[model samples]
Target: MAPSTRRAYATGERSFTCYCQSMNRSPWPASSDLVEDYVTHLFNTGIASSTLSVYLSAIARYHVMHNWPDPTQSARLKAILEGARRMNGVHQDQRLPITPDLLRQLHSRLHLTSNQHIDQRMFGAAFTLAHHFLLRVSEYTSISPARFNPDATLCLDDVHYDRTMLRCTIKQSKTDQRRNGVTLTMQRAESPFVHDVCTGYSEIRRLLYPANFPFFMHASGRFLTRSDVTEALKKCLPDSCDRMRYSSHSFRIGGATAAAADGQPVDAICKKGRWKSASFQRYIRPFPNT
Candidate 1:
């Protein structure tokens, strides 16, 4: 399993163990009745059935690893899981993408200019890159945004620029399970793109962060966090758009949607987004008429 899968499984197992402890039941070698009870207890608490499935899978995997009978294989438990699924189903919220025009508005509204320090400039730059580069917010920012992760986050050295174009390297991504590095390049856009990049570059040397630091490091010596990015985006969103319905991910989808709407080929968008499968289609939601 991948590191993320391991972490999730560990979390599920821990939750189950805690529940078992509270109920005075053995987590390992737990009875089918006990397992059913636990699932029922969790389901009644409004836990999503999908999440409960992970906990059960973790329990099953644990039993397999221990050479014990898999309690999750019980027909009764399976029925309960199915029942939970039927009861809860899937609840999805529609997240609007941040289209190109909206992105331009964000830059303008943030007042990203020479007078603004890198702290203020960081949002515009980060937002622009994620849109243009189809970057996951996690690929550029830290897991928690407040800390640093040289192995994954965008470091200053990972980005390069020239008169005609800007190039970036995404060192890690969820899809690149093999840890292979991926690079994204974008030719400089019309006026504002050049201005944003130039302004950010001019401030980097004067700022406290070193060459090895995160590219979007705040003036306060912290990497620009996800919360900060979200807050900035929400601040600049047009009055008609619901800020609560979008997130850092909206930029990636918005870019893809705009590209498609502008007649960019699907294969080209797929390549630019580094998507190995046609799953990228789902990200390109219908661009609103607004």
Candidate 2:
């Protein structure tokens, strides 16, 4: 699983474990009825609907993994999900993506022009890849520095490439399925820029670590964590800025949004992103119509 996904699973597991412990019960050997009871208990205790939803979803997954039936199929489960309504005092607000101009400004703040620094090099690679390739942080992190040629160029072997055209073969995706492969033919203005950022990132890693090291690592020399990337983004941008949610996955969104704005075909964008289905359109939502 990707780091972000791992974090979510960890959080869910912690919540489930805590809830079970608080009830003076070991949930490890729980049955479907116990899961349903837990979901009901959450609602009766006035837990927030969204939070209860997360907890329930996690429990459901746990049950499914154990070959137990889902709570939703049970009468108690259905009631917990749909019968109870939110209190009038609570309002669920939908969040929106950051605007393009703000993103551009954020990008500028992250990549300084004259002086070069280690942190800058790290963020620059992350920001540039997200800006162009619509890459998930996982995709960037999955790439090993050793994969690059001696000149620091991506060998273009993972995907087929002509003199100016490239076809990316995504063997595995976030959804845990193999994509049918994608081809990208960069325009004159874009290819050089993408190549330079990728090369510089490889060089930075090579300078800091011995040959055959992971592409990105912490001061402790372990691979960089999702939190590391988030902290770097937060540090690079202004303290007061709140227009963007700015998770590592934002890079994937930024890529899709930029491609859509530039009039790339939706089919091409979908292939490059390795979205298993159109359901992913929900994640990108509507890009700047301009």
Candidate 3:
């Protein structure tokens, strides 16, 4: 299994084990009836249907790996899962997109001071890069404190810039299970705000880091994590409500939504976002109050 898949399954299995322990039930060779009951319990806890499905998958994988009968495969359990979906609803809580107007506002409002100039510049560059490249947080920042594989992480050398274009190579991605990488290029936007921020960031980063260091870094010289990026973004947002609705994922969703609003074709958006399927439609939210 891929590292990402393994991590997800590990999380699901841990959740299952905790549930079994709380209920005084054995999870290793769980019965169909017990599995169904657990599914219902999880639904009652307000987990989305998609999350419940992942939990079930984890349970199935565990049973297969342990050479036990997979209770989740029972027809009765399947019906119970289907019923859980109907009862709980499948709609996911999506993050609000950060549109171009919002991006410009953040850029203008987040001013630099002598005391923290480097930090502000880093955040500005990181934010602009994420929006321009339609990047997931994990694509540009590390999630773990431990050392990451070069094949799965973005290093400083992955970025290349020319007179009019900025190109970034993603070493690996969730969609690229084969470990084959992809390159994304961003030309100077007509507004120049994003381009200017990115260029300033690159110049600052060159002074602070070695060639092979991770591209996104904190003031302390550590690689920026997802939480770090999110907190920085919150500081840039104008209000508490916008801060609450936005997250690292807002960059990708916002870019896709903005492109759609500009009348860009679906295929073009998918290509730029590196999505292999029509699932990109899910990211194109209607503008607020429209």
Model 3 clashing-pair count: 0
- What does candidate 1's lDDT look like per residue over 11-84, in tens digits? 99999899999988878887788888988889999988668877877887777667787787788887887777
In terms of lDDT, the poorest run of 10 residues in model 3 is: 107-116
lDDT of 3 by residue, 1-290 (tens): 33566688788889988999999988888888888888888878888787787788788877766788878878988788778767766686568888887877677655631146777777777778888778877787865544545665677789887668777898876555445788877677543666777776877787887867787776677777777788777777776345667898888888889888888888878877878777688888866521
lDDT of 2 by residue, 112-212 (tens): 42144555666666566555666666654543322322222222233333344434333334543222334444543466656565556655566676654
Best by TM-score: 3
Give the runs in model 3 whose Cα sits over 4 Å from its true position: 1-6, 11-47, 52-88, 112-114, 144-149, 189-191
TM-score of each: 0.68, 0.54, 0.72
Ranking by TM-score: 3, 1, 2
Clashing pairs in 1: none
TM-score of 1: 0.68
| Ten contiguous residues minimizing lDDT sum, candidate 2 | 147-156
Which residue runs of candidate 2 sit more than 4 Å off their true CA positions? 1-34, 63-104, 111-119, 130-196, 203-212, 217-228, 231-249, 252-282, 285-290
Number of the candidate with higher lDDT, 1 or 2 = 1
